[model samples]
Target: MVDRLRFFLNRIKERLWIKPLAMCLLSTASVFLAKMVDVTEIGQIVPLITLSSIETLLNIIASSMLVIATFAVGSMVSAYASASSTATPRALSLVIADDVSQNALSTFIGSFIFSIVALIALQNSYYDKAGRFVLFVLTLSMFAIVIITFVSWVDRIARLGRVNGTIDKVEMATAAALQRRRLTPTLHGVPPGTHVPGGRAVYGSLIGYVQRVDINALQKYADKTAIRITVAGLPGTFAAPGRVLAYVTADLGDFTDIDICQIEKAFLIGGERKFYEDPRFGLITLSEIGSRALSPAVNDPGTAIDIIGTLVRLFALWCAPIKDNENIRIAECDRVEVPEICLRDMFDDAFTGIARDGAAAVEVMARLQKAFESLATIEHPVMRDVAICHSRLALARAESVLKIHEDIEVVRRLAKFGNSV
Candidate 1:
């Protein structure tokens, strides 16, 4: 089973399917065909037993439309399920190092959001007939809920750095801790500025089109319209560059190679966010900057049995009875061992929108259906089980979505603000 799971995960990792979108178009044709197909199936043996031409046509049209609708919704659910539950192993290097992908996190979050919208829409559906409406949504919602649940697990697939920059920073700090390194030795322990040794420089007696104001040019300067600073970093620091080089505090200087100490006096006290947001933050990923980021090839069918191995690693980490003691073995490639607190955090977050009580369950579930549909179109067994667990336990029992809501403030915050902009 583990081998098969790994093999299956490998087969469709990055496939781009157009089938879901085609469903509506194909269904339209199918609906018309269903209408015509009904004619041959129903023989005009007697006048009373047989319907007239107009009635038969109407019946065919209705049946065909319903079938098309169901087909369209089913295709959508399958697409979402496939993407979320793909089980593709991430980039090999990253897996070995345990570096998580930020892209996957974003995609997971995005898929989550999309699933919510789809589910909401699916639940709100209005079919031509009441029974058809319930059937359409029941089928659609099940698939969609499964998708949302599967995508929820994408975090497990994601690399750590993608979710929390500080996680990697802390790991880097740990490495730094082992070595004898000087941190801001020159800054006298103050929060130090960064180096800009060879980058371009600007001078400023600055002036530019500013937001509409009643002030005159002199008044603008008097009001410090251009925030001026006498910086060793030089003139461009305070002024806009595109406009006639705003007043320069210093004579123009060209960038030149110099000793590290020479540029150390200068600081990018505030500009680093704009300057290095890309390379500093973006360049660190496993994938190259211009290309598609990390794609783990963990799911090869031939080596798929190893997925069970990975699952064992994951499960030992997941269901390990012990906490934080290194006696339990997880993975050979694993660097940092799993802590029980990690699973605590995940399950803590999982209960955010869960339902409790029959009436509330119906409503929250109705809402869940809507949300899951929009965010993703999931339909995996494990995912279905999670939703069903909630439905059976929390909703049926009238317990809070997060059973221990009061005990977990973090979960409460996440639930209340999950949709808040």
Candidate 2:
């Protein structure tokens, strides 16, 4: 339930309208809230604020905020487009969810709504002397908030859609997902080992990517039915009409249609993969950005090189040793079996495209080799092996593509150094 709620909240955040809508609601509420000041004894002591003063302030906000809000929307749209074109389209979601931009937009729209609502109330003579003063104070506070938010937002907007900023955003999101998975690799379930018990395969009715799996919900159902469930459709897995989402082992006869529906509900199938639960998606998106940079039109090896560095940092998170207290892996749902994310798959996602597209670029290959060397030095045997394997693959790609002998030699030397490490 917790996982499901978190996933839902993440999806909600991605919607550009959610914040603005929320702000509008609060703005409307505040206008009515000022009416309570009229009933308070403090209203008698407070100096009377003239109706014209409050009206003039609100008129200023009402006249200007809509235009500012429109400008903000246009700026955000351009930023989104810039992110999609400069980086991978997959990263546009992260760009859209930027808090500063959203807050600024909300403030602009909220201030507009507040002005309009307060204007309507003032026209109707809804406020007493104290209510008018309270409203004036609220208006001043709103103006201050709008000014501060706009200033911070301007700084953030300057970089929001740039290639480097987009890359940083993707890296942070990927690192967070990787760190979460590092702590709970099995999603708090038993590891699906070499052998999984045979059971009735439960296929998803919908076709899409598995965005999230509710392991606790699955465990509860499994406990009720005294069955073991092996999850096959992890997040990022493509699910089709006939694809098996999980294998349900039950002593009873086949599960009813409703039972199957309930089990499938535990998996949230979405049209596109999300970064929240799937770390590989982030890696793949980063790789895509690098590949785009290496394209003939872009031809930006520096971006590709920077992406290599980011991948190294992310992979290091996986290789870092878990704290002693966290070394113990306890399966919160013993009846549910979830396969661990493959190190080989992560390697392929992070490096394969860059290796292929940037093979002929000596600078990219050299940096790639250096990144491999760094990963090779990690103490984890699996990480070392995966790093070595990718190093060889990238070296082979480089050798095949480089026409210059010295360039080939440089990559070869770096590859050899990585191997030795």
Task: Write one digit per residue (lDDT tens) for candidate 1, span 190-286.
Answer: 1212432222333323242221111122122322322221122211122344422211121234223222222222222222111111111111121
lDDT of each: 0.28, 0.91
The residue-by-residue lDDT of candidate 2 on 305-378, one tens digit each, is 99999999999988788887766457899989999899999999999999999998999999999998898888
lDDT of 1 at 197: 22
True lDDT of residue 388, candidate 1: 38
Q: Model 1 — which ten-residue stretch has the worst lDDT?
A: 274-283
Model 2 Cα RMSD, Å?
Answer: 1.7
What does each candidate score in C-alpha RMSD? 24.9, 1.7
Clash totals in order? 38, 0
TM-score of each: 0.17, 0.96
